[model samples]
Target: MSVTAQCPRPESRALRENHPVMGADWGPFNVIDTAKQDWARGWAALKKFTEREAHARVPYEHKEGAYPLGQWVAEQRRAYGAGQLAGLRARRLEKLGMVWSLADERFQKNLEAAKAYYDQHWTLCAPRTETALDKPVRQWLSNLRRPGALDDHPEWKTAPEAVDKDWNPSWPADWQRHYAALRERVRDEDGPADVLPGFTVHGMDSCRS
Candidate 1:
């Protein structure tokens, strides 16, 4: 599973400072959060094919309030490869794409659920400290950032690191050194309890929820 295409540009806080759009982007999103409002717009676009106004629709709602990630992933692969779909010539393709979009919505739901679950469990196991931390905990956070890491674990790929590097200052050299040293210390203290847990195990367990 490979993720191609560039991530969308992040909206500036200055542009969003006092005014934010209001509507259900998706989820339990409050109309107040600028980012969430943006997401809601995206969610609405994906949902267009399913709306009653559309010429076609698919019964793609997931039961758990989240779309099936594996299903969404499969459809996406089809869309990207020799199986690209569009218009009347590709009615099946367009329909599947709509379902895929619903699957995406479901994925978002799962994301929120997983984040909440981890946040709750995280607060339980240990206090937030600069020193020692749980390997599982780190993996959980990492999985949230990159869902595909669970199966592929693509370390070679680099994603957009800074939200706006030109506008925002990069981490200081000393800060990087401190961070690396902090991780090393935490790993050493963690002993052999899988000092570095990958997304595989934790991610699988999370989806079960």
Candidate 2:
């Protein structure tokens, strides 16, 4: 329901180049891409839980392969939220946080499954396991580069626009745009029959693998 933290993400090439220590300061990222109307309400009410890891074969990007959007989302929600309970201190979020990390040791297994599921030979979606090079620098960046920032980080030198200026409370502009796109409710181009000729809707994840 309410996401107050961000699961660590691998730095984009743009980010890493601009801010070498890009981890500590980015802030909470609670958005998950889903079309389920009950997501927010469901998340706000459910207890944290996990199931056995699963996989499937599917076609993607003009080719056929296997996908782990299933397992990846599981880890994305379950494993990432294991630490949320303490912060929220509310039984509801705590309940939603789960007893502990699910798929705890299945990172490698799930990643392989997701990577192979896509039709193309893609590898960029893997989870981030690396540590930032400098904690203080990263933290400064997260606070919108408050004080004692790197004098010449690429961001400050060539791209001042990359600096954070808005400080209200809602999602940043770019992310807001992204969420707007995802949260929009629009009719399918025609209908499922017109588009998905042979696809399977796998629970929340509709795919044919």
Candidate 3:
């Protein structure tokens, strides 16, 4: 049977009230794909990455390569209030050097999980903000790492891939195959498919518990 549940919407007030660094500014990062698949994959990546990174979504307004923290904050303030501002401040806290995951067991586990996915999936680009095409992707990855308050979003636990903005791979590849399989489920029209062909819905079931 198919399942019907509401996807999490932006919780602006919760983010604003909880996050400490409310008015700070952040980056000009990016992620680019060598090619486009169905729109679903790209959208999922964008959502997943943004949620993971904790960056608020902004319209693609600035001309490429000039995603200013000040500009993003100014734009988001009208709706997101201090929550978006907090994301900016948190960006400064990002550690630039190599981080050893083994130092923390829980982090190590998460890193291992991320690495396994990274190894299994096809990531066509390195994700950089120096260029116009890759900026959004880069910022998304940055946010996922330090999601301060946005971590409360339920999608963080369910359909995690939905927010990873940097996700991109060539067509007919394994990741594309995975995406295509899931796309079929979305087409059911009435509700989400309980089991998508060729993909296993693992830990997601545990969420019901």
Choose the strongest candidate by TM-score. 1
Per-candidate TM equals 0.21, 0.15, 0.18
What digit string (tens of lDDT, one per residue) describes model 3 on residues 79-181? 2444533343233322211112212343334434444444433232323441222234334434554646335644343333442333433343344435543
Which residues of candidate 2, in runs, are more than 4 Å off? Answer: 1-39, 44-92, 96-100, 103-209
Ranked by lDDT, top first: 3, 1, 2
Q: For model 1, how does the per-residue alpha-carbon lDDT over 1-209 read when each residue is reduced to its tens digit?
A: 99899753556433344344422233243335886464344344445534634533333343213444344434444665555644452444355354434545644444444344434333212122311232343333344346454345333222212211111114442333333333433555646433242222312222121
What candidate 1 gets wrong by more than 4 Å, as runs, is 1-49, 52-57, 60-83, 86-107, 121-149, 152-209
lDDT comparing candidate 1 with the true structure: 0.37
TM-score ranking from best to worst? Answer: 1, 3, 2
Error of 2 at 21 (Å): 47
Worst 10 residues of 1 by lDDT: 160-169
Candidate 1 vs candidate 3: the TM-score winner is 1
Worst 10 residues of 3 by lDDT: 93-102
Candidate 1, position 189, lDDT: 62
Q: Between which residue pairs do clashes occur in model 2?
A: 25-142, 57-209, 58-209, 66-117, 67-117
Q: lDDT value for candidate 2?
A: 0.32
Q: Which ten residues in a row have the lowest lDDT in candidate 2?
A: 118-127
